[model samples]
Target: MTATTDESAFAAENAFGKGEPNIAYAQYFTGDSFLNNLVTDPECVVGVHNVTFAPGCRNNWHVHHATSGGGQVLICTAGSGWYQEEGKDAVSLTPGVVVFTRAGVKHWHGAKADSWFSHIALGVPGENTSNEWLEPVDDAHYAAL
Candidate 1:
């Protein structure tokens, strides 16, 4: 007997592969943005946050907070961008490549020096998940990229 499962949210719950679930739409975050909800799972608390940086937009320095520890991943799906940590050098990123950071590091990321940037934010699991925003990435630093 087939015990069919109710379609909770992910439209392609029964899908094989190679496509996002119907429920997971390609979202666009025009202006400044952040995570809306944090995932709650034992295996790994994971969530996807879509961000779009305007021509000259960027985020301030920030740190992730998790009981077990967590890091941010930027999967560039469009345009170009730069990422920098507190004491590390800046790195450029484009479509297809994935960038990562440590569990808790002070850093900032944003669009490229001459274009907009967009990526999906994914992180590990944590308790009392939160963030601490420090300072914005100045133009001098951005232009250096």
Candidate 2:
């Protein structure tokens, strides 16, 4: 192992990497809504992120790999949203609603098609937690919302 020393590099900070367009994921899931992932803990630590959905927005199908042994938790902070597991009906997720995702379960979630939504997402600290980003839910699937 290479020996390393602790250091701090503080530069002029202006934003929390939010001003840019469609930066977190890669493409727009729904309108301007996107995911801001902060994988601070590589393993044995917690990970955090935020999902902000604009009016008439949603997200594509995706899954989270267990880090150590836990899954993910989503705390709705503003507006409204929804969460559903694979092969299950969508559940309503509004302000004050907390949702937990099962480890290694394939699922998708986002704001209601007609409302803006924002939520803080957190995952358990584990050994090499991974994320599998799947296909975007097209208009056909979104129209059903």
Q: Top model by TM-score, which number? A: 2
Model 1 earns a TM-score of 0.66
User: Quick one: best lDDT, which candidate?
Assistant: 2
lDDT of 1 at 32: 41
Mark the regions of model 2 whose C-alpha exceeds 4 Å error after superposition: 1-22, 34-44
For model 1, how does the per-residue alpha-carbon lDDT over 16-111 read when each residue is reduced to its tens digit? 121222232113222343332233455564876566554455777788876676777777666667778888888776767788776678888776
Please give the CA lDDT of all the candidate structures. 0.59, 0.64
Instruction: Compose the digit string of candidate 2's lDDT tens values, residues 4-119.
Output: 11111101111122223456665637567555665655663666776766655666778888656767888876655677777887887776789888778877777666565667
